[model samples]
Target: FSAGNNENSIEAHIGINGEANLDFLNIPLTIPEMTLPYTTLTTPQVKDFSLWEKTGLKDFLKTTKQSFDLSVKAQYKKNKDEHIIPIPFYAKDFQVLSTPNDIFIPAMGNITYDFSFKSVLITLNTNVGLYNQSDIVAYFLTSSSSVTDALQYKLEGTSSLTRKRGLKLATALSLSNKFMEGNHDSTFSLTKKNMEASVTTSAEVQIPILRMKFKQELNGNTKSKPTVSSSIELMYDLNSTATGTINHKLNLESLTSYFYIESSTKGDIKGSVLSLEYSGTIDSEASTYLNSKSTRSSVKLQGASKVD
Candidate 1:
């Protein structure tokens, strides 16, 4: 006898090879459940031998986990669209031969890297000119064309002698010593409706001194390097003198007078941080002397301030 089950029912049959068979047509089967103790799943006092820890499998897993994260990031970056930025180009003495548009960077994945011309063989010449008035006039051998042209136009239409004299004096000065530093030229006209003659002189002096001094200031803790502070002080002095004669043509005799001005600047430095203090004083005197008749005036001014 043999037993089998199908969709309809379970069956039992008896048969022999190459012989007539008779069969039990219908039978039913039942499956019964078995019970186990919960203690079987509880942790045992004796632990299982760990091949994973002994073979460093945990470290391997950790490393591979990081690799998985990197692989995911790489895939995400690869699937994204490329970004492009325009490069501003400048040229003075060289020319570009070739430019590349795209390259692969590990940090940024596939990025559009623009590498341009780096090396080329070329010869170049540049000109930079520095000139003083003495040199420029010596080169041209005459007044500048612009000044000459303007003077010619003004000379044709002007009738005032003082104006003509002023223009001539300006041309002479420009041709001779316009840019001559610390040069004093004395020439004046006393024949106009309002006649004035003056000599002006100015001088500037600057003295800069750098000083280094050790200052012990605690930054925060005791074991760090001490900060070093540098102090700079600048002293400046300016002197201006004007000697002149004024003729007011209106019942006042020509007066000869002189004016003197002096100014002194001083600076003070303090603190580890950058700081500056400045003080200045100005002294001025005006005096007119003619034939033992003299008038005098004087003024003094001072100021100070600090900056941080």
Candidate 2:
């Protein structure tokens, strides 16, 4: 779920005035998925054909049922640097209201560092001069169960070095025993023996190079006739310099295999009614220095019928 690196440098400057400096650097990367059980309320009811013999509502009620699914994924990274300072100190224990019963001494050190990152979320706390001459560092990274738990497995690695020609590399891998289902919502209903169904699928992926996020979705219904629909979307980082915040959204729509359209729109709209729909989009961005991002979204409608 997470990984990190820590390095310490003891610099000795030999000059008119001899000086010693200690510096520490830390970098961590994490991908965590957090998921919560989807909840819904269900009600049982009886239906009679005589009640809606001539109403379309009766036909609609007879054919459809409803269901929902939700999921989320988050990615995170953090870097920290600190200057270390050693202190000479000693501590003695004594009775609160009487003469000292025992005496002890301990050495201590202090450190200061700054941390920051994205996608996976994290919190950090660093303590200087803890338990004699030691520095304490701690962090937590969290992700949506739908994202992290869904991955069958993952592999990660890191490499770093200073002015020296030597390089240090570390790698990690993890696998999940359970399958994480993608985000999906569906409705099913029964009218007599005939059944009707509708479903929607949604998903998101993070692109670190461009510092952006991408998402896509599809929604449609199943009927005796060919009824299909789908959508796509993209998001990007508008401010790559300051907060690294992102702003982007593109969309696409398709009907069967015959027509396709990509656009940004709100509210309700209608597209061709075909047996299938195919839609997709690509979202990417790059900053001037050390910042790049990319993402993609796609949807397809398929059936036994063949279309060239």
The best candidate by TM-score is 2
Q: Model 1 off-target regions past 4 Å? A: 1-170, 173-298, 305-308
Model 1 TM:
0.17
The clash count for each model shown is 0, 22
The regions of model 2 sitting more than 4 angstroms off are 1-182, 186-208, 222-224, 238-308
lDDT of 2 by residue, 74-145 (tens): 222222333445443445464234433443332323222222221221112221111112222222222222
Per-model TM against the reference: 0.17, 0.19
Model 1 score (lDDT): 0.26
